[model samples]
Target: MKKTINAPKAPAAVGPYVHAVEANGLIFTSGQIGLIPETGELQNGIEAQTHQVFKNLQAVLEAAGSDLDHAVKTSVFIDDINDFAKVNEIYAEYFTGDTPARSCVEVAKLPKGALVEIEVIAVKKEA
Candidate 1:
């Protein structure tokens, strides 16, 4: 069975799902938006939102005993596909090495009208 994972530094989930779940040696994170944990507010724009998304993902991964370096795959959802280049810039900042496989798409809407949302799958590094 899978075990749910939560990050105290990340925004609390507004839905039923936990921030992530670990099964075996892999962790699957639920889509994370730009909501700030302390303020519970969405970031101002795409750039800020993208950065917040990564930070949130990082926190969850850390809680799951993993990090971006171990990420095997990721999915990015944005309200405007045109923002891909801008978001990609921010994303590249996090996954600096051999980047994980990723899929990005434009969505009509997101929770709390977030500009972006991201989800990741990563391997738990040997402790």
Candidate 2:
């Protein structure tokens, strides 16, 4: 059985999609932009947005009974490839242990004009 996740601590979905879903021991998350949960506003700049993206991912992962440490893969999308270095620096701060496999690409745009968006695949923590 698959379980859907809707994280209250993360920003609400801007579209008709849930935050994540769990099936077969794996949790797959929807892409998360830097929309602030409390305010529903996009964070400013690449750096701030990158950090906020991680915060949103953390909330969704936690809601799915996992954390960054258990992540198996990640996909990052950025509005500009030039911001890769800044985004990588912030990304490093979050996945410091047993980092997951990742792919990043520059997209022409994202929902709500976000600077960055991230989604994850992780194993549920052992209970």
CA-RMSD of model 2: 0.6
Question: What lDDT score goes with residue 72 in model 1?
Answer: 98
Q: How accurate is candidate 2 locally (lDDT)?
A: 0.95
Clashing pairs in 2: none
lDDT, candidate 2, at 74: 96
Model 2, 44-87: lDDT tens digits are 99999999999999999999999999999999999999999999
Estimated TM-score for each candidate: 0.98, 0.98
Models, CA RMSD each:
0.7, 0.6
